[model samples]
Target: MAVYTKRDFSVNLKSHGGILILALIAVFHLWIQVTGLQYTTAAKTGWIIGMTPVFMALLGLAVFKESLTLIKTSGILVAFFGLILLISHGDLSSIDLISNKGDFLILGSSFTWAVYSIVNKKISLNYPPMMTILFLFLMMGIIISPFTINDASIQSVIHLTFKGWIAILFLGILCSGAAYVMWAQALKEMESTKVGAFLYFEPFVTVIAARIVLNERITLLMILAGIIITLGVVLVNVNLKKIVLYKKSKKDM
Candidate 1:
């Protein structure tokens, strides 16, 4: 896609920074996420990964001096609580992370992704989105090549079924390629905190997808949690001044 887009391959100091950010993004978003999932339940992974928005908000305020409005802070807390409810299924005791290696790894990934999003918001504007994502996939392949170039990896790929190939293609194309391009474009257009808020929907989408794909049963609690997540996202994106002025205008009418 990057090649087809036909952007110039210019190199500069700022371009180097873009490359470094893309490398970090590739490592945390792809490598750490995949590794952490190996050690944790999908539900737990979803919940842990869902914390990226909260981390982004906190890190933005701390590192970048970004403002944390009341609405945004409340939304982060509400969305985080909703994630816990969704993943725990009303049993809060099961939300243990200290003993689980996978949980820690995923937690680290979540934090790194927040850092990446905040940093990338400024850096991504320097290059074309598709080109940056193209370099990102390249960096991921290079990082994994040492581990995946062995005979076992080769044999595994050789033995992969047609369905497995299709799945791999889907992940490579849609999940990594297209998703990163869209994320980059979003960061260019909106605040990183706002863009991160949309990530809260990931687990909500996962739940619905699981019901359809894995035949997993969705309970009423999960539905309620989804609603809460949606509400929190709305709050994060709402314009308080606009709402106040609109309300005053209506009163005057």
Candidate 2:
């Protein structure tokens, strides 16, 4: 995490392979709006698909002898249950075909994110974590340039009001550019499982941002879902060994 503040360009060399993977993630994020528009809202399907990483990790444990402690297993199950609860009300069956398309986009996004996480770990081995992330964001921005056109979706850019320009600036500079850098840096020093834990914070941030910007309602269900999702995130990232040790100490006392 200190890599975020470290100014060691010589330490962090960018790889073409990693750049390509990060670019794919940026493109996926750019297109994710299509999923929201089609689905009419972000729903459980995305969360359901997103939770596959836990299962994949489990399978790796079973097949490749990865460690599988009780706490970790419990965390995964809790997160899965929370995700199910998060989107329990929606029925994806009504629009099966388009629903699949939306699901595909979100799943693709998750895969890219996972790939980025893996690549960050590799790149950070030799380079400064911050530099690795900066380059990744630059590559991602370049890759997504075609999609961020000043056309229909970018009408605000064309007939720019002050607020529109501000929104654009916030999204481009602060949210997309800066946040990507932070994420990349985080991925560098942390295990993918640890950094990927931040994803549960995503829905909360989106909902809060939406409420503030779009003037959307802060529903009772949304609040409950956010809390549950947060709990899931906590479970996923909790140090199982530490928890066990602490409990053991308490029992000894």
Query: Highest TM-score, which number?
Result: 1
Query: Cα lDDT of model 2 overall?
Result: 0.59
Best candidate according to lDDT: 1
Off by over 4 Å in 1: 39-48, 98-108, 246-253
Which pairs of residues collide in candidate 2?
A: 11-127, 12-127, 12-128
Candidate 1 lDDT, tens digit per residue, 7-97?
Answer: 7766556676667766857675767778887876565555567777778778878877877799988987787777667656678887676
| Predicted candidate 2 versus true structure: per-residue lDDT over 129-248, tens digit per residue | 556666666677677677677578577456888987887789987876678767767756665666666676566566666667666666576456546555655665567687799999
User: Model-by-model lDDT, in order?
Assistant: 0.74, 0.59
List where candidate 2 sits over 4 angstroms from the true fold: 1-14, 33-38, 42-66, 88-104, 145-156, 217-228, 247-253
| Cα lDDT, model 1, residue 133 | 70
**What range of 10 consecutive residues in model 2 has the weakest lDDT sum?**
88-97
Query: For every model shown, what is its TM-score relative to the native structure?
Result: 0.82, 0.68
